[model samples]
Target: MAEMLYQRDVYGKALVELGKKNKDIVVFDADLSGSTRTSFFAKEFPERFFNFGVAEQNMMAAATGLASCGKTVFVSTFAIFAAGRAWDQVRNSVAYSGYNVKIVATHAGISVGPDGASHQALEDIALMQAIPKMNIIVPCDGPQTREAVIACIDIKGAFYIRLGRPKVPTVENKGKFEFGKAQVITKGDDVTIIACGIMVNEALAAAENLAKNGIKVRVINVHTIRPLDNDTILKAACETRGIVICEEHTVIGGLASSVQEVVAENNPVKVLCLGIKNRFGQSGSPSELLKEYNLTSFDIEEAVKKVIS
Candidate 1:
């Protein structure tokens, strides 16, 4: 088994690494520094971190203010608060004029487990995507989370990076992470399985299983959803018989919608989306939640077969 690492575990250390190099890099947390792992950066640069207790809107607004001062600011909190509570502020303040504020929200999707529906941020990506120019990146595991954090140092304008609460198994990914490029893990012509975040690992497992059963499957890891990597995704759609999009988010307005829009506009292929199907999350263990939501590797395998059929 691959060594499991919490996706947010390396986040603090990565922020600290950036803090060491950049004096103008500041961070804002809405009383979730510990959970978001921004505490490491706070401990490293005490003067550069600020905590606004339970005021995500204020925290986001202040983060934009710092960005206006030509500082690269990062705002951290639960995804529900960052994308739900501070949405108006995030849209009008941060994304309006393309301010350099990175909103890295932790505990996204049903993987949040006992945090339940109230705290789960299944709609975060959809909300962030509503604002034009808000970059979205959902790193699948710890290693990619580190890469995403470090890459945000130079990424201009507003960004929405989604991270989960529990430890995630590192999936097979080759080469350095390019901001807008999708990593094609395995190449096949029968079908393409494109996924982001924790679902990437499940997609890989499904692909491997399908390969064993003599069904060729292509796996594409789309860490950056905003930029969408149309080139790579379109290429896969053109080459493959069908497409299966997997996300730990809602099927309506997240990865599934984005891919469908792109493919429909360009090539119009048979696509099946395996994700949370228009239902709020409920409390359970991470594994149990994944199984209940039908987001496991077995689900992806079934979705792939359906798309091909």
Candidate 2:
């Protein structure tokens, strides 16, 4: 873990970078241009930017139309509305058609803080996971967010990127970003910690703490969830005695479920998870919410120990 940065802040700038490269790149926002940072693209290319004034469904439908005409459409809005409110269009029009639309949703998970449960999107991943032809990317920090932004442009199909509002510790991952590949941050034999988004940093911290106790913990950053890097995941499950899956979303249908399904069918290792346990988020500071939901490094450290035991 290193400097703190917001993935959405990096995403806003990355859109401008992509716009300058491709003339057919269009951006759509649900009146959250400033918050979601599609305003960066809005500023650079106002002619290509469209604001739907709070209608996420309309924005998604219009984006689908643009994509059908061979335009690479990038849509932005809060995570809740981007995945929940406009899901019909996202599923029926965008995903069902298999267009080149990228839904870069910000303010995801319970870390939106004082926004309360109404704004928090604990089920965004699950909702998108239910849809077909939708690639999901949960970048750990700003650099990876930029990497994902550039990589998704060539990927033919719809993509849902989940980004949070608050600044999170940067988890350093070696090598260039590859789509649908997992980065093993550390090598361990006792246990493996598979995580995404801000949880990557927590996994790293937990690995460091466990090291002092003479435990070898391998940490994996699975940025792309849709086409999950099953080879790396299965390798980790085979090399380690146990595995711990971590994410900021719900445990039911999110990262944990995905890893468990693969492991159960393949190697079948003892697994533990750190995430929301079937409940809504409440208004609180980001740090408080993380601890309240048992998503801190300390919680991960404990889980690793318990898994090993």
Candidate 3:
């Protein structure tokens, strides 16, 4: 099969489509508009675009104000700044007030590459998932990122959509996925690989490679980090003897963390968590960083065999 195109253009294209449909839709950026692809919306609707410089807190407050007034506001920035810089505004103004503002944060995880630990957002998912009334989403690829942006407008509450700096493989088609719904990319009985964000592609590739060695693997897309699809995870875990979770985020409080939460309460099974193992990122390309952090497809395949062995 031919490989699908991978680029951040999916997000840019989705913003353009949404901007054309809804007049209440607005975008706010914290000096990283070009990087986050919110600049695409700004291009068409310059009147509705607001650049908040580097003041992420003010941008958060402004987005909350827009949401309160019935406007679907999208706040864009790097994941590090979105969570680390404006976390107070997000928790107090957005989550505490229960605003409908969408936090479309990008450049998440070790995939950030080149920027190092200061810019990489390894712990963002854990921090945001702990907040009350916050909807957490980690889209697998660009197409899913576009879907995530469109879905954030309909969901009424504080939302965090984690995006990456790298262009990931498009394993899913538009409108074929949804929020709080897990996508089972592949099915098997030996082990289930529940993943989200960029790791979805990695898990799928790992599954294909594992099949050559006679290991059966199931791949699932756990897109919604908060309000996680517990039923799908539990079902997959119960059917498969073991589970392997893959993500571009830290293993502490991301897809793997959510999977563990469900498996611990419902089913007892052997689980292998694949991600950054409690370490900060360094400057390099996305692929280099993933390999350095042991988040490559080979690593995932090896992890599955280890758990089964």
Q: For every model shown, what is its TM-score relative to the native structure?
A: 0.98, 0.98, 0.96
Evaluated at residue 109, the lDDT of candidate 1 is: 94
Error of 3 at 51 (Å): 0.5
For model 1, what is the error of residue 286's alpha carbon versus the real structure, in angstroms, after optimal superposition? 0.9
Model 1 lDDT, full chain set = 0.91
Q: In candidate 1, where is summed lDDT lowest over 10 consecutive residues?
A: 168-177
Candidate number with greatest lDDT:
2
Task: Work out candidate 2's RMSD over C-alphas.
Answer: 0.9
Residue-pair clashes per candidate = 0, 0, 1
lDDT of 3 by residue, 1-309 (tens): 424433356776787899999998889998888888888999999999999998999999888888899888888899999998889999999899887888888888898889799999998998898898799998887677777888888889889988887766678432377788888888788899888887887888899999988888888988898888888898997899899888887888777888998899889899999888878889999888889988888999998998898
212-236 in candidate 2: lDDT tens per residue?
A: 9999999999989999999999999
Q: Rate the local accuracy (lDDT) of all candidates.
A: 0.91, 0.93, 0.85
Q: Give me the runs in candidate 3 sitting further than 4 Å from their true place.
A: 1-7, 172-175
Report the Cα RMSD per candidate.
0.9, 0.9, 1.6
Global Cα lDDT for candidate 2: 0.93
Query: Model 2, which residues run further than 4 Å from truth?
Result: none
On the 0 to 100 scale, the lDDT of residue 254 in model 2 is 85
Q: Is candidate 1 or candidate 2 better by lDDT?
A: 2
